[model samples]
Target: MSLVRLSIKGISYSQTQNGAYALILNEVDGERKLPIVIGAFEAQSIAIALEKEIRPPRPLTHDLFKTFADRFDIVVKQVIIHKLVDGVFYSSMICERDKIEEIIDARTSDAIALALRFDAPIFTYKNILDKAGIYLNMSSEDKSDSEESDDILSTPETFGNTSSDEEIKNTYAKYTLAELNDLMDQAVQDEDYEKAAKIRDEITKRES
Candidate 1:
C-alpha cells in the first residue's frame, strides 16, 4: 500500500462522548480528513504539545518520554498509523539510535503527541485513509473563520453525532475575542487543556 503524508488539522471536543476529543489529521495532498476519537488526557497532552506558547510547570507523560529518549539518544524519526481494526487505529514509532532503527508499537494518540515534540513526520497507508477519511462539504481553507470552524466541528458519522455550531457558539457567546483569548491563555497556564481547547475553538469561531 502506498503511504500518504498527513498533518495535524486541529483538535475538537467530541460532542457525543463525554471527556473525549476528535483529533483530526489532514491529508497533505488531499482534502479528506481522518478523525480519531481520543480520550481527554491524550487530547490534553496533544493540545499542550501544539501550543508552543504554553509550557507546563512539569513534563507531561509524553514530555517525559521525549526527555528519556534524548538522554539515551533514542530519536523518534517518524510515526506511522499502520493499521486500523474496529475503529481503533494502530501506530508505530520509527526510532533511531546508534545508527540502528526500531519500530515501537504505540497508541495513535501517544504517537502523535510524541511526533509533535520531535518534529517528526506522520503518515498512514492509502487504504486506511480511503476507509476512514472524512470529506468536508466545503473547502475549509477558503472558508471564512466562522465557516471553517463550523466545517471542522462537524464530526464524521463514524465518530458520532456532532453538536450544532450554534450550540458550541452559544457556550462562549458572551466572551469577546480578546476575553476568550485571555481565558485560553489562563486555562493553559492552569494545565486545563480541555478548557483551553474549548475556548480556543470559540476564538476560532469568531475570528474573521
Candidate 2:
C-alpha cells in the first residue's frame, strides 16, 4: 500500500454537539485533507500533544501509556491512519521493540493521542485519503467556492468560519485550565479516552 504521510492541519469543534469535534489531517505532499469526527476528549488529547502542552498533576491515559512504553524500552516510530470505514477512521501504531517492528490496531483518536505523546509522525493509506479527503481551492478568487465545498463535505454538522489555525486556537481558548482539568477527570472516570485526550490538550495549550 502506498503510504500517505499526514500532518495535523487543525481541529474544529462541532457547534451542534457539546462533546464532539472534527480532527482535520492533511496530506503532507498534497492538498487532500481528511476530517475525522472525534469526541471532544479525543480532540483535546490530540490537540494537547500537537500543541506541546503540559499535563496537570495527574497523568492522562495517553501519558500513562507513554510512561509504560518508556518503562518497557519501546519506541513509537509513527502512527498510521490506516483506513476509513463506516464513517470511522482507523489507525495503528508502528512501534519498535529491540529493533523489531510491530503494528497494533488502534482507535484513530487514541492512536493520534499517543502519537502526539511520542512525537511520532502520522500516516494513512493513499486509498483511504482518496476516499475521505477534501480539497480546497486556494486561488484567491475561490474563497467562497472553497467554503461552500468544505461546508458540503464537512463531517460535523456545524462548520466554523475561522481558518484552521485560528479555529484550533479558539477551541483551546474556550476553556479554562481548571475546567479542562475537570473535564479530563470526567472523561477518565467515564472511560472515554478520546475526551480525556482533548481535555489534556486544552490544559497543555493554556499552560504553553
Candidate 3:
C-alpha cells in the first residue's frame, strides 16, 4: 500500500470539546487534509516544538527522550501513524540504533510531539488516510501553485508552510511571563505536570 506523508498545518482550540485541540495535517503531495482531535497538553507540546521554544530546568518527558536518544546516538528516523482503531489513531516511532531499527508503540499525540522535536517525517498507511482524511477545497484561484507540489518523498514541510512561526509567536505572546508562571504553578497544584511543563516552556521562551 502507498503511504501519504503529512505535515501539521494548524492547531486551534476546539470549543466543542472542552480542553481539546484540533490538529490539522495537510498532505505533502496533494490538497487533502486530516484533522485529529487531541488533548490540551499534547497541543501545547506540539506547539512548543513547532515554535522552537526552550524549556525550563526540568525536562519534559519528550525532552528527556530526545536527550536520551542523543546521549545514546539513537536517531529517530520517522514517526508513523499506522492505524486507526475504535476512533483512536495508533502511531509508532521508528528509531535507529547501530543500524538496527526499532518500532515503539506510542500515542499519536506523543509520537507527533517527539517527531517534531527530532525533525522526523510523519507518515500514514494509505488505509488510515482513506479512513480519516478530509480533502479541502483547493480550487480557489488565490491558492498558490506551490501548494500542489508533490514533496511527500522528502521531509514534510514545517507546520503551515509559511505562517507557523509568526502565528505561534503571536499566540504565545499574549501571556506575560508572570501569567505563565502562575499558570505553571496552578498546573502543578492540579498535578497536571504535562500542562505545567508547557506553561514552564512558554514562560522560559518569553523571559529569554
lDDT of each: 0.73, 0.66, 0.66
Query: Which candidate wins on TM-score?
Result: 1
Error of 2 at 48 (Å): 1.5
Q: How should the candidates be ordered by TM-score, best one leading?
A: 1, 3, 2
Q: Whole-model lDDT, candidate 3? A: 0.66
Quote the lDDT for 132 in model 2: 55
Q: How well is each residue in 62-177 modelled by candidate 3, as lDDT tens digits?
A: 88889999999998899988876534567889999999999998888889989998999999988777655554443365355534532211012111111234544675578877
CA RMSD (A), model 3: 16.0
TM-score on alpha carbons, each prediction? 0.70, 0.66, 0.66
lDDT of residue 51 for candidate 3: 72
- The C-alpha stretches of model 1 lying farther than 4 A from their native spots are 139-208
lDDT of 2: 0.66
- Residue-level error in angstroms, candidate 1, position 178: 43
Error at 59, model 2, angstroms: 0.8
Against the true structure, what is every candidate's RMSD? 12.1, 15.3, 16.0
Point out where model 2 deviates above 4 Å: 140-208
Per-residue lDDT of 180 in model 2: 70
Ranking by lDDT: 1, 3, 2
lDDT by residue (59-113, candidate 2, tens digit) is: 7788889999999999889998776544456678999999999999888878888
